[model samples]
Target: MKTGKLVIGIFSIVLSVIIGFQSMIAGLGNTLSENGEAGGSGGFILGILMLVAGIVSIVQRSHRGNAPVIMFVIGGLLGLILAGSYSDLYIWSTVSLVFGAIILIFNIRNKKIAQQ
Candidate 1:
């Protein structure tokens, strides 16, 4: 069970990194619209947040914390708010949100088992 959680955590971290890079690359091309200036900036920030979340998730030995949850959630929200005209940004952000939820669920389950 612990190994499973670690695997998921690692997967989530890798996914976040992939999504972050994707968002940033797309962000570069997103600088041609009316809101272009704000587009890349938000994606960049979102990417950074996602990366931070990934880092946090990997650093924590116990999967029962809320730091990863919060960071990923914030990253997801930022992606949604910042994804004005970029369609890809929406997908990336949504994925980040899902990963956050996955982490949350895992954490909760871990806590429950610990209690037992």
Candidate 2:
């Protein structure tokens, strides 16, 4: 669990950094499309939420069971869904889904553990 959290946390941080960089390069006024359209900041909020969740998981190492792990899985799915446009988003989404699968498998293996 500790290892899984650490890996996911690091990946989340890297994703956040990449998104931040892209936002900076694109400028705050720039929209996802030339029509001045956007996803209404949901993507940005989700990225930050994932980063925080990862950090919390790392800090609360031993407490891993189901809920947090499930959150990671959901985050991964969200990433994949959001990846339709941004390249960095796609990369992170792929990474998250892969790592999330690994973590989910580990969680499933410990059947004796009760879900919180």
Candidate whose TM-score is highest: 1
TM-score, predicted candidate 2 vs. hidden true structure:
0.64
Q: RMSDs, each prediction?
A: 2.5, 3.9
Question: Against the correct fold, how does model 1 do in TM-score?
Answer: 0.77
Q: Summing lDDT over every window of 10 consecutive residues in candidate 1, give the lowest-scoring window.
A: 31-40
Clashes of 2: 0
Q: Which lDDT value does model 1 have at 77?
A: 91
Error of 1 at 9 (Å): 4.5
> For residue 58, what is the lDDT in candidate 2?
67
TM-score of each: 0.77, 0.64
Off by over 4 Å in 1: 8-37
* lDDT against the true structure, each candidate: 0.71, 0.57
Give lDDT: candidate 2, residue 24.
46
lDDT of 2 by residue, 1-116 (tens): 56776777677777766665564444343463454523224246446656765676566556545554555566656655654444555565556556557656655654446553
